[model samples]
Target chain A: MRRTPPEKPADYLPIAFPAAMLGLFFVVPFAIMVAISFFERVQGGFYQPAFTLANYGRFLSAFFGEILVFSLFLAALVSAVCLVLGVPFTYLLTKLSRRVQVAWLIGLLGVLSLSEVIIGFAWSTLLSRTAGISNLFVALGLMQQPRAWTPGFAAVMTGLVYQAFPYTVLVLYPAFSRLDPSLGEAARTLGASPLRAFLTVIVPALRKTLIATFIIVFIFALGAYLLPQILGRPQHWTLSVLVTDQAIYQSNMPFAAAMAVFLVIASLVLVLLANMINRREPAS
Target chain B: MSGRFLSRVFFAALALFLALPLVVIAGVALNEKKTLAFPPQGLSADWYLQIFTDDAWRAALVHSVLIAASSALISVAIAAPLAWFLWRRVAPWARIVQVLGLSPFILPPVITALGALSFWATIGLYGQPWTVVISHGIFFVSLPLVTITLGFATIDREIIEAGTTMGADDRTLLKTIVFPLIRPYLISGFAFAFVLSLNEYIVAYMTIGFTLETIPIKIFNALRYGYTPTMASVSVFFVLVAVTVFGLVARFGDLPKLLGAWDEGER
Candidate 1:
């Protein structure tokens, strides 16, 4: 269409509705959370209107520190595992025919659409003693009996990885598919093994994307609230679980808000870092 | 040959691992036993039947459908025009508007939920279904925004120029040329938003509180206390909904391009 003149005052009308909606519901709530994090926690599981740094101070305590550290460690682990498994898998996907690639992509989107609660409990059942993969182990004489895998770290990691794997694949697919097939083929013709060429050439070229995906997945895993509660022990709870606990269960909204503030800040930083990396590389 | 064979085996195993839990949940829903079991003591449709028969499950299903439908409608209503404005006119604030639309999606749902919870409470609108509808609509606006932008990319500039040279106003042009061309994307965006809203839990739980029950909240409560075959059946229902929604999107739209994996000059 011919370019419409920019002089129409009506040009600005469409932005008004969505802008106000986002401002009120999205930006305003975040502002409230920030303000509430500075409020004082009171007796009887309530918060007072006094200005205080106590909530932030609470985050500096050994207990909260441990929770934060463990959450970070778990998120890092999940991202690493996703990268390890996702890289090869996406590479293989790129090697497939376009029809098969589309089919796999559709299947992945279906899995990705499944809610965390469903994914969590589905894995819980799969790892439960009565009908778990352990039973298959027993049936095949790989082990003597079924074993409960829930209420443990491994099971939690399993669910996290399963949840994150599709995302990892989706994020990496664009980059991997855009890669020149001739690059690897040329490397092979130059007398390097296929595996060796991938490790040396392709992996290095994709280093930025790998890091970006890792940070994206890491931040996502950090915000995970339901998975730990569903699949792991109390010690396995992430900071998100603690935020909900302090807010809803313990009625300590200030503490919960404070923790959420830290969580959001950390996530924002990582997202910004990923954006920077993407800007530098432009491919991802 | 050996290396390729090994790689294929590894890929198949990994694919199976990715799919195992979901497949197992569906299978367990077929169990005739009261308790969940893998081999499913005997095949039956009773559990799936329970989703419709049980009052709480039925209510949750209805509530989820209403919320998702309304949210998708609200999202498309807001995003469609905004996308058109940004695409057609060079506005100074367009980048800011785009960021505002997408920030909810990029931010953690927990943060958005807490914010929405507090924001709604302040406005004395907490625990209302409309709060959830609005919250979800805003949170997922990015999906439609992106889809609609891609839809705009598909419009030929020459056709647009020809329409303008015919003295058609922007409104008439949008209605006649742009809307028809972008109808698939609009539908795809709505479906994408609907599916996401249906699957979302935290924002719905936080904004609406416990007063209104959505399927995810009900599932969370059930899973917390204990596991039941009924819960598995409910999950099966969700998996089916997701499959149906995404399948439709795939059937009608460019699923891969929609997912941000388009090749150069392909679209």
Candidate 2:
């Protein structure tokens, strides 16, 4: 059956409703944020209407620079860890029976539903001196005493990685499941060891997916606000924590907006890059 | 094979790592003491009872439910029409709309929250519950958009032609054909958005703050000021809620398809 494309009048209602909603709520606000970043910070925790580059200039400080660098590093680390752990787990997942796979997928979805705040505190309790892994170690005679591990980098990383691991698996699962098992079989028929066949065949095949997963997880970890604040010390606070601190607590909306603009730009670039990679290999 | 054994061991250990914190929280929620402990001094449901009976926790629970329900409705309302239009006609403007709609979610919540803060303040809507509702609706519209798009993909073109041959208008076709076929996706999308909004924190904090206390914010404050078994109990409540919602989606809908794990093209 030949069908005609819907005409202009018909298109107006569908396009206009969502467009208006997004424009007013999403795009315009971002524009306003960018505009506010240029406004002057004035007395009494308010900003003046006068245009200035003062907020962006404040980002030039070494302290803000350190925070931004540390955030990128932390996000990179989390993404790397998720990829390292997720790839093998997903590989094993694809090898499972269909029913078992569904069960595990549902379990991962349930974990993914947990809010960062909840995960952070859950890990904090798990890492606390009173009833943490250290206590288990002591019970096993592996340690002399329980140790307080919260408000530290390791604890923060654990929380962030736990929050991100599900995402990494979900993202990679579709690609891995779609892969032909015969590819590995074909390699093994040529006398390649199982490890060698996997490394040489599957690893190369999922290269783009691996990079995409890394960037996705990296961006997610970069935007983390509650986790770092809950699980780590002041020095470990990410760029997100600083943005909220400056905006709400410090009452420096302009500076906060400026930092936020920077954060958005960084995220935007990574997302666009990922999109491009996905486009380049649409099948993957 | 050694490789198979290694994979099994590695997967088991990682799964345990993922489940450990949740298991510990559930254990601690049964503590008889105020302080959190794993080998709880004594097992009791006092913390759970406290969550159910305490005024602050009860109010927060109610508020969270209200906000999540409203936001999920708004998201599906917006996403349904948008998905319908895009599926019917692949207009250039539709591509732009799709990007704009989904970008809020792709970008960090902090950025969107900052934008919402500035925009709401400018329009004098700050500290209002509706601001958070609208913000969350925009943030999570992507979930329904993706689901509904997949739903639309499943409709055979011939079915649309058949409806047209019967002289059914677009609205009639949608009501008679599209809605019924896409109903599960719509429900799944709603459940997805509801669960996510329940878990959302930064945007809620930035937009509504103390003006309205949602569960996440309440739990966050509790954790920051001090650790308590009450907070652990709240976390348990959240886990249970998430499981229940997703469980329904899995039971009634195609969870793998909703997750985009199953390719229609392949079939």
Name the lDDT value of residue B235 in candidate 1: 89
TM-score of chain A of 2: 0.95
lDDT of 1 by residue, B197-259 (tens): 888899898887579888888888887777668888888888778878888888877787777
Clashing pairs in 1: A1-B160, A1-B161, A2-B160, A2-B161
Cα error of candidate 1 at position A196, Å: 2.8
lDDT of each: 0.85, 0.87
Candidate that would win on DockQ: 2
DockQ, structure candidate 1: 0.65
Alpha-carbon DockQ of candidate 2: 0.69
lDDT of 2 by residue, A143-224 (tens): 9999999989998999999998998898898888888788889998999997888789988888888887789889988988
How well does each candidate superpose onto the true structure, as a TM-score? 0.95, 0.97
lDDT of 1 by residue, A106-186 (tens): 778778878898999899999999878898889999999899989799988988888888888988988888887888999
In the range B1-267, model 2's lDDT, one tens digit per residue, is 887788888978988998899889989989887868888879999999888799988898888889999999988988998888888875765788898878877777899989989999988889998889999999899999889989998888898899899899888998999899999999999998999999998889989986998999988888768777877888888888888888888888878777767654573
